[model samples]
Target: MINITFKVTVGLLATFGCYILFQNKLIANNVFAGQTEEINQNNNEVSEQTNGESEIDVVNFNRPISPNPVHVPGWYFVPGFITQPMKEYNVHLKNDFQITAKVGLNNTASSGFGGNYFSWFVSSDGVNWDKVSQNKHSRDTIDTSVLTDSSDTEGVRYYQAYSEVQPQVFNKPIYSEIATVHFIKGDVNATEIKVNTSKDYLVSNPNFDQYISASAITQPKGATGRVIWSSSDTNLATVDPYTGKITANPNRKTGTVKINAEIINPRYMRNSNVFGYKELQVKKMLEIDGETNFQNTVLFRLNPDFDLSKSKIEWFQKLDNQVHKFTNISDQIISKEIKLQDNNSEIYAVITPLDIDDKPLPNNATESNHVKIQVKDMPPGANRNVHIRQSLSNISIYGNSENIGVHQLLKHKITFNDDSETYGYNDDNVDGNLRIPISINETNIKIESIPSGYVPDYRIENDGLHQDIIFENFPIKRHFGFDLIVSTRVDKIIDSSFDYNPVYKYRTLFNTDETVIGKPVHAEFSTNTIEINPKDINFGEHSKLEKDDVNREQDLDNEKFVDIRDKRIKYSPISLFVSSSGFQRKGAPVRNVPITLANYDENGIEISPKGNYFEVASSMNNSPLKSVFWNRKQGLKLKFNKLNFPDGDYHTTLYWTLEDSINSQTK
Candidate 1:
């Protein structure tokens, strides 16, 4: 009975197994046939579409796979096991003629499933498709250059990312929504490199378009190309490497320079070169008063034809066969008045052109014309007044109208009507009034005395220092002569050795809002020397160190003065600092020492016994500072700190620093 039962069970089991195998085989065949039919249908449509149109070369891509479907347990088919479809993707054409497809994967758990392969395909006609040959995997991106040859065609091409998985059960491949990219015919070669500039020359210093540009022939008619700009002479001009713009050098001379613009990749064209020059020319001629005699004035003017926006103008007076150059002359105005000197004099002008940076042009340049004038001595005269010894005449000339630090005194003496022929005059006149032309820098003149029965009239011309004093025509004159003194004051100190000594004599009118005398106000140490020598301190071996005063005064002649100090700070006092290198016993280090200053005053005065010593500066661990007023009389009294001393003749070096600055003064 048991044997019979076993044979029956085996037969039934074999029948059941055969039924399951047959069903799986039928399902697999159906899935394969469905895929084959779809592929064949697409190929037939592509063939029909290409009958009259251009044919695209398609590359076949295939991946090896087992023919039989793998078996999976029913538990493996979880609720979310289905592969999710891609949401979004795009195709791009790179500069290197490669096509890149970017795909966005679905953020689902099934994204990590096996056989999550994506097969990318492209088609000129929407019906025809060919798989891309590169990186056909489960990645989110695929790049191929196969379609680059067709990128020149004028039409739309379609692409699709077909997703498939090696599933245990037979199923159709999942297809994503189609994406498209449009390619229009393009002419990529650049044919010409044309260089263009707004202007050929640089006038003065302009911040406009002082550069050159370049364009080339492309598919789009007005497309720009990558160009490199260069200059033939860097000293004369320079060009920006990437901007293709040109600029004149700051110290460029009056000459021409060549500018070149070349295409970075000159496939179908050549480069371009242009000639540029500086817009420099003396448009107006120098004019001056031709002739003048003693007590007369000469006028010099420059026409506003030349561009002075970046140039400097200088006036010169040639007197007594010596050329004297005028300093601090107006750079904004074109006219000037000169006073006649007491000698044969000639007045002229010098114009210097500047580059964009306001630096002088390389070549030495000047523009001017000379005017002749005569200055005569006094003629023999008996009625002339010589009793009035030097009368004081005060006048405000160039410089701040406000109170300045100090004014320099300029004095001049003049004797008139001594001799008519001395000034190139042949006729001797009895009733002649002498006219005295004053210099731009001369503010006032003093007269010794007026002739009897003769009154003097002072006349000013054009709101300037130019003036004429008319004396009553000498009555019963026998070559009358008079003594005259001229003097002026300047805020800045004048040094006799300066090449432009006359510059300090005149005030600056360049900027009316900031008019200054010769130089601005400033203060500094009395001398550049930093070492200070103090009186030796003597103490008995048994006596402890005691503080003492070292009376010291800065030499006014070498102290803070105008034109010699920094002129940046307007209203501020200078700072005085004192430091020491400790005390040395017998020229060897003994102990740390400190000192102090007291009774500081601008005027050098000895402090009274009852007077308190000022704690202005001290040489303690810290270097103490003190304020030094500019207007106050400055003096110093040094004090030493009390300390036990090793009595082998202690010595120390002191450093005194007077700094003129806003920060130092505030500290």
Candidate 2:
């Protein structure tokens, strides 16, 4: 009986084992279908969550379906539905443009059990679904991928997930509600960003306001991201963070400064170090100050607040729109005596800033306004108020007072043919001074007249063309008028042979060869003649007298032959006269005029007995003639001597010569 029982039990156990094996194979073959159905249902639920718009879920229908396997008797049973299903899910995006979906579950620990898994789905549209990836167990989160469709246009990607689960009572897959996300379809390429408004800007005020701008030529026009502004030298300038406006720093020195702008977009320029940069140069203005109109000396200076040590300055003169550069200049204030031309004009200053190394800074040169130079008065000789006086006077004949001294006077009037006239009494009130503010070398006056007597005597004070005259002292008065006197005194005897034809010439002392020949002052006097009436030398009656010393050693006899003698006699003095009309006045002094006489017996040969030949009317030395005295007269004394001789008519001619040697040693 035991044997029979064992056979039957063993056969039954074998049959049961085979049966379990076949069922396991069947579950394994059918599990996939159930999981697929659960996934479809999950997708439908996800579609419901997405506003009831169902998406065409494409799956790998060719993939093998699987079934759940039964456990053996006495095997431990662990519940696959330990955690609840996920209800809602959301898709999140990061800065790197990474998208991920998180499913909301009642139980946070929602790992799938049995032959189940979790899958993520993505689609360009709700109609066509594309598989992203599948996980072995359903989880709370899953990563996703967004790609470009056949067209290059980027579309909003619709996303969904499926959680294949095995509940204690059912075996299927469930899907969470769809979480849609819009992603960029193509690769991120940084737009070429450039800093606009990059140029040198002029700063008028100490605080200057400038702006910087940026541009991108890529996919999005306005979404280039945050813009940042920076300055290469903060001491020179500063820029605003939010606004790209640039401003000069406080107490900023004038120079060239650089500014930069950048973009902070990761999607676009991810690998680029520099986004957009530009060199914005800052410029400051220069100015000049001080007086514009000037007479002799002027002071001009530059306005401060600029680095003059590292700068260059130039001065220019502008006349009739023409520019002329001044070779001599000072960087700062300039005080100099200026000479203005006859025309009207102006001057200007140009300043240029330089770099540290003394190079000209770019776009930093400036020019100043024109300063005018003008004169205030008119020039000399603008009118005709000057003239020369012409008159003759002083004539008298001297005779023995016992003879009633006869006198004759003749007044000669002279007329100047040229405009070289003298200042008349009518010109006393007119102004003849030079009014122009310039230097004058010389001026002239001409006097003319006719006379018949002694030449006028005159002397000039300060040498020739006196340099003591300058613009500082003007309106020089020239006195050419004078008084004349001519008289013959009986007390003096005139030499009949005296000659007065001496010429006084004017010459510049600087060069003896150079003479003021043709100028206003030239030769001055004419010839003069002296006449004397014949007079007899009388010694009462002739007397005879004896000289007792013939041969005193032989016989001192009073009876010796006697000799007769008469004393010599002196004649009355005669005088010569001179008038003002014959005088010549050089604006300067004249040298000593000499008088010489040559005695002859009507022959040109000089005779002997120099003392008896002739006597001079006057002697001269190195002294100059006085100008104040208009007339001069001098007398010559003649004496007679008698010797024992026979004579009928003894006549001798005296030649007289006068010379005017102007000073040649003037300094």
Candidate 3:
């Protein structure tokens, strides 16, 4: 009873709540409520049926259109049929959608609308369509256009097929990016210029006019060229512009002249090349008054006759200040005389070529030739006075002989020849201070000069000046003489004093007594006699002994004295001999024999007879006596403890006087 009453508001609210619940369930289950499974199945079957029918319908439609109809999009066009031959047709999809088109007549259909060939076209907007044909058309048959469709759900863009008969349809407008380039310029200016001479130039006469040719100017890039030449301040040199030649004046003085080369180039400015200056040495032929006689007056002349047109002569004198001053003389070919102030002085002349400015030309100027003079003196007198003197020519007797016994005296005197009446008295001065004593028997003294080759006019006198020159007791014999070759004139005078006889004395006495019997006795004696003469003596008068005359004599004397002493003997042997005879008698008949004899016997001994037997006789005889004498004397005895004697001859004379007194008286 309580549930039967209901409100309209509550009912509505309940209905709304149920609707919200059902929407939520539907959202959660992800399902659709309006369409059932059966309905979906039925719809799918219908779709299959419709597809089958559509496919069939399409097949039928394609068959009726042409036997090989190419299906394209839903809207396609075919060209009108003509008598042209049929060409093949190809269809391609656009945006993955199938599209086909054909224009060929089919025998089965017997009704084709267009020509035999067909082309396809595609466009996403459907306005600008591109043909897609298989023919030789510009457009490609394969789809290349990008298609967009409103019904396509996928966000994919792709190319559609397009073909055209003309190649212009594929080419389109194209633009390249913009770019820029730059460049710079380099320098091309010229720098230097050079110039030179062409050939050798002669500066002499007769082609002395030869000129030095100028060479062409060589300039660097971008420059104009010109040349100008100027010589040194003196106008001796000049150059011609047209011929490019440098010429020298023949009359120009000899010296170095500078030549300037001016280069006229616009780019190089006023540049100049200064060539080495040419040297012009002057030359000329000139002669002085012969070189043989450099003294006295001198003359100067020009060779080849010194023509006035060729050369001129100039005179110059050198002063103490070393300056050459000009003289007042004008001559070229003519000879001019010059006087020298002093005999030992020198004079000179200068020659110059006759040309403009009196300049010295090449091979023309001659240096001044010098000359010197000499002087002589006076003569001597005719008659002259002279005197002669005696000097030791030599003392050679002792020089050659060493034995004192052979030493001889030698003397030499020198004389002079006297000229003119101024002669004085000649005297013999002994020059005793210079004299030498000798031990010789004889000596020849002479007065002579030293040497020959002198003029002779006077004589020499050999007075007592060369006195008794003697040499004694010399051991060896030698010859001695003086050199009479007078060094000057001498007067010949001879004088001499000599002792040629060397005397020796000797004496001896003998006493003898003898005993014993008769036997014939004999005594023998011998003696030594030394004979020395003037010929054995030498006085050392030879030239070789003149150096030591005094010493020569002394030495010889000492040697001779030693030899004499050695020859003297003392108590030499005196031979004595005695003889005796003895006899005995037999005693008769036993009778006693008595014999008596004297005890001492002086001379001959006697025998006496007595008694009965014949007396025995005995006699004693005295020996003869002999004494040895040296020369004429008994044995000479010289006693000396010690003596030093040289080897030489000692000349000594000995006389032996023998006295023998022996008497015998027998009774």
Each prediction's Cα RMSD?
A: 34.7, 43.3, 63.3
What's model 1's overall lDDT? 0.34
Q: In candidate 1, which residue ranges exceed 4 Å CA deviation?
A: 1-226, 231-240, 247-253, 258-450, 453-480, 484-667
For candidate 3, the lDDT comes to 0.25
Highest-lDDT candidate: 1
Candidate whose TM-score is highest: 1
lDDT of 1 at 68: 21
* Candidate 3 residue spans exceeding 4 A from truth: 1-201, 204-208, 216-224, 233-235, 267-667
Q: After best superposition, candidate 2 residue 485: deviation in angstroms?
A: 62
Q: Write the per-residue lDDT of candidate 3 for residues 411-527, one digit (tens) a residue.
A: 323232323221121121111111122222223333343453322233223244442222221111011212232111112222111222111111100011111111211211112
Q: Candidate 1 residues 450-527, lDDT tens each? A: 343333454445344234444433222234655455454443332211111111011111101111111222212111
Per-model TM-score, in order, reads 0.20, 0.18, 0.15
At residue 109, give the lDDT of candidate 1: 23
Tens digits of lDDT, candidate 2, 1-667: 0000000000000000001000000011101100000111221233222111243344322112221111111110221211111111111122122222222221112235333355656666566776764432233323222221112243445545454544424443433334333333232333444553422442323322222222212223222234455777777677654334455553435466655655455444556533555565444333324333323556655544333554567877666657788787846566645432413556656655554345664455545444456533323232222332223322232221111111222222222121212223122222221111100111231222233231233322334322121122112123332222212222222221111111112111111121111112111111121122222211122222222111112222222111111110212222112111111123423322121222222223334433432322222342221111111111121222323323222222332222233211100
